[model samples]
Target: MRPRVLMVGSAPEERGGIGTVTTLLLRHGSRHADIRMVVTHREGPAAMRLRLWLSGTARVAAALVRGQVDVVHAHVSERGSVVRKGLLVLLAKAFRVPVVLHCHGAEFADWYRGLPGAVRRGIAWTFRRADLLVVLGSSWRNRYVELLGVLGDRVVAFGNPIELPASVAKPAGLKVVFLGRFGDRKGSAAVLRAVAGLPVELVMAGDGEVAATRALARELGVPAEIRDWLSFEERDELLASAHVFVLPSRDEGLPMALLEAMGHGLVPVVSPVGSIGDVVQDGENGLLVPPADAAAIRQALASLLADDGMRARLAKAARSTVEPFAIESYLDELAARWRSLTG
Candidate 1:
C-alpha cells in the first residue's frame, strides 16, 4: 500500500523550493508507493497534481482520525515561519507520523549564530524532536550537530535538485543573466554596477529590485535590460542563449536558477554563500567570489568571456556534476527516506 504523507509549510502552496521539493517527492513517492500533501497555501505546478489547502491543525487531527498519515515533511524558512512549523511538527508527532524538517534558508545557523547560549538552546529545543533534519550542505549539517545539538544521524546533506538538459551548450553571445528577486540580499544593484561601461548585454529578471537595479544601471551608465520573471520555458531559452549566469547573492539556498543554468551548460559566477559550496566547486563548475564584491564579480565575468573554451569545459563538468542531483534521484531518495521512517 502507498504511504500517506503530509507536507506542511507557511507558503507551502507557493512556487519555490518548498513547493518544488514536495511536488517532486509526491510524484516519485507513487513509483515506490503513494503520498499526499497538506499545505498551508497550495502553490506551484505540482499543486495541480495533489493540491491541498491549509486546513490547519484541525485537519491534522481530522486526517489522523481517517487513517494513518505516514510522515510530515515540514519546510521552514527563517522569517517567522518557525512558530507555525514547530507547532505542526508537534502536531504530526501527536498524530503518530514521523517528521522530516527541511530548512529553506541559507543562513540557518547565522540567524542564531550570535545568540546567547540559553537563547540558542531555547531555539534548538524547538526542532529537537524531528526524526530527520535536512540541510543542503555539509557545513549546515555540522552547524546543526555542533551548535544545535541535533544528532549526526538525523542530519542529511542534500543539494537543490535541478532537471538538467541532456544537450550540450552551444556558443552564444556575451549574455550575462541575473535570475532572482530584485532585492537587497540578492545584490541586484551590485550586478548593475559590475556591468556598467562593459560591452555586454544584461538580462535581469524578477521583481522587487527592478527599479533599483535599473536606477543603478542608469546612474552607472550601463546597458542593462530588465525582463519580468521568466517562465520555465523562457528561462530555458535565456539560459540556452546566454554565455554566463551570474548570481551575486548576499543570501542563497543553492539558488535553483544557478543549477538550472548549469543544467543548460551555462557557467555560474556567484557569492560564496550557503550550500553554494555544495555545487559551485569554485573554478570547477563555476566561479565563487566574495558577496557584494562587484569589482571581483566583473573581473570574473571578463575572465570567463575572454576564455570560451574554459567556460565551456567548466559548464560541461558542472552539467556532469549535477546529474546525480537531478530531480528523479532527489525524488527517489526522499521517498525512500520517508518510507524508511514510516516502516
Candidate 2:
C-alpha cells in the first residue's frame, strides 16, 4: 500500500521556489505515494494568513486523530516558516507520525545565527526532533549537523528537479534572461549595473520590490525589459528564446530558475553561493561570479557574449549537468524515502 503523505508548505499557486517544488511533487508524486497537500502559508493580509495556518493545522490534527496520515513532509524556510513548520513537526511527533522537514531557505544559516540564544535553542530542538531533515546539497547537510546539532544520519541531500527539454532551438542575438525576485538578496540591482553598457539585451522577471528594480534599471540606463512574475508557459517561452541566463544572488538554495534555464540549454552566469557551486563548475558547465560584484558579473557576461564557440560548449554542458536531475529520478528517490519511513 502507498504511504499516506501530507506535503505541507506554501500555496502551490504562489510563485516562488518552495511553491514550485510543492506543486511539482503533488503533480508527479501521486503515482508513488498517496500525497495530500496542506498549505500552511500564502500571500495575503495578516488575518487571512493566520486563518489559513489555523485551518491547515486543524486539518492535520483531524487527519492524525483519524489515523489517515502516515507521514508529514513539511517544506520550511527561514523566520516565520521555521516557526510555523516547527510546530507542525512537533504536532506530528505527538501523533507518532514520521516527519520529514525539508529546508529550502537560501539564507537559513545566516538568519538562524542572528537569533537570540534561547530562540536558537528552540529552533534547534524542533530540528532535532524531526525523523529526517532534507536539504538541497551536501554542504547544507553538513551545516545542519555542525550548527544545529542534527544527527548526521537524519539529514539527506536532494537537488531540486527539473523537466529537461527535449531540444531548444538556438536563440539569435545576445539576449540574456534573469528569473527571480527583485531584491538585494537576489542581487537584482547588481545585475542591472553589470548589464548597463553590455552588448546583451536583458529581460528581468519576478516579484518583490518591482518598483525599486525598475527605478534602478532606469537610473543605470540599462534599457532592460523588466516584467512582473511570469506564468509557467511564459517562463518556458522566455527560457527557450534566451541565449544566456544570469542570477547573481547573494545566497540561494539551488534555485529552480537556474535548473530550468540550464535544462533549456541556456548558458548560466551565476554566483557561486549556496548550493550553486555543487551544480555549476566554473568555466565547465557555467560561469561563476562573486555575489554583489558588478564588475565580475560584467566580466563573465562579456566573456560569454564575445565567444560563440565557448557559449555553445558551455550551454551544451549545462544541459547535460541537469539531465540526472530530471523529475523521474527525483520522484523515485523521494518514494523510497517515504517507504523507509512507513516500513
Candidate 3:
C-alpha cells in the first residue's frame, strides 16, 4: 500500500500561489501516493475564517487518532499562518508522524525580525523540531538557518513549478502586464506612477484596492486598462498580448505570475525580492528594480520600450529560464522526496 500523506494548507478554493501549489500537488500526487488535504485556512471574514480553522484542526486531530497518516506536510506563511501551522506541527509530533514544514512567505524573515525575542525563539524551536524544512529558494534557506539555527541538512530549497504555455506570436503594441494583488505590499501604486503617461499599454489584472488603483490612474491621467479578477484564460490572453511583464512586489515567494509571464515569452521587469533574483538574471532573462521606487520602475520601463532588440533577446532567455520549473518534473521530484522521507 502507498504511504498516506496528510497535506495541510488553505482550502482548495482559496486564491494565490499557495492554493495553486496545494491544488497541483493534490491533483498530481494522487497518481503516485495516497494524499489527503486538511484545510486549516480559508477565504472569508475574520470570524468565519476562525471557525473554519477550528473545525479543520479538529478534523486533523481526528485523522491522527485514526493512525492512517504516515506523513504531515504543512504549508505555512507568515504571521497568523505561522502560528496556526506551529500548532499543527506540534500535533503531528504528538502522533509521532514525520513532518515537513514548507515555508512559502516571502516576508517571513522581515516578519520574524520584528517579533519579540521570546516569540522569535518560539518560532525557531518549532522549526527546528520538524523532520524537514522546505523553502522556496536559497535566499530563504539561508535566512531560516540563520534565524532558527536549523541544521543545513534539514532544510531544502525547492522552486515552485508550472505548466508551460504554447509558443505564441508577439503582439503588435508595447503592452505591459501586471497580474497580482493591487495592494501596497504588491507595489501597485508604484507601478501606476511609473507607467503613467508612458507610450505603453499597461494591463493591471487581479483584485484588491481596485478603486484605489483606478483613482491613482485618474489622478495621474494614465489610461491603464485595469481588469479586476481575471480568469485563467483572461490572464493568459493578456500575457499573450504583452511585450513586457512587470510586477514590482515588495515581497514574493517565486511569484506564479512572473513565471507564467516568462513562460508566455513576455520579458520580465520585476523587483529583486524572494526567489525572483534566483530565476531572473539582471539584463539577461529579466530586469530587476528596487522595491517601492517609482522613478526606477519608470526608467526600466522606458528602457525596455526604447529597445526592441533587447526585449526580443530577453524574452527568449526568459522562457528558457523557467523550463526546469515545469509541473511534471516538479511532481516527480516531490513524490520521490516524499517516498524517501516516509520510508
Deviation in Å, model 1, residue 207 alpha carbon: 2.7
- Model 3: lDDT equals 0.87
lDDT value for candidate 2?
A: 0.91
Model 1 pairs in collision: 13-41, 13-42, 13-43, 14-43, 182-209
Give one digit per residue, the lDDT tens place, for model 1 in 39-109: 55443464542333345556766777677577777887664566667777787777677898987776666
Model 3: CA > 4 A from native: none
Q: lDDT by residue for model 2 over 1-343, one digit each (tens)? A: 6999998889998889888888888888989999999888999899999999999999989999999999999999899999999999999999999999999998899999999999999999999999999999888888889889999999999989787778978757888999999988898888899998888899999999999999988888999999999998899999999989989999898899999999999999999888899999999999999887899889999998789999999999999999988998999998899899989
Model 2 reaches what TM-score against the true structure?
0.97
Candidate 2 ranges with C-alpha deviation above 4 Å: none
Candidate lDDT values, in order: 0.76, 0.91, 0.87
Q: Which stretches of candidate 1 lie over 4 Å from their true place?
A: 10-15, 26-29, 41-54, 114-119
| Candidate 3 lDDT, 1-343, residue by residue in tens | 4678999989866778888788778877877779999988987799988998999889889999999888888999899999999998899899888889988888888899999999999999998889898888898888889999999998988888777886768868798888899989889989989988899998898889999999989999999988888776777887888888888888888898898899999999999899888899999998999887899889998988888889889999999999888888887777777787778
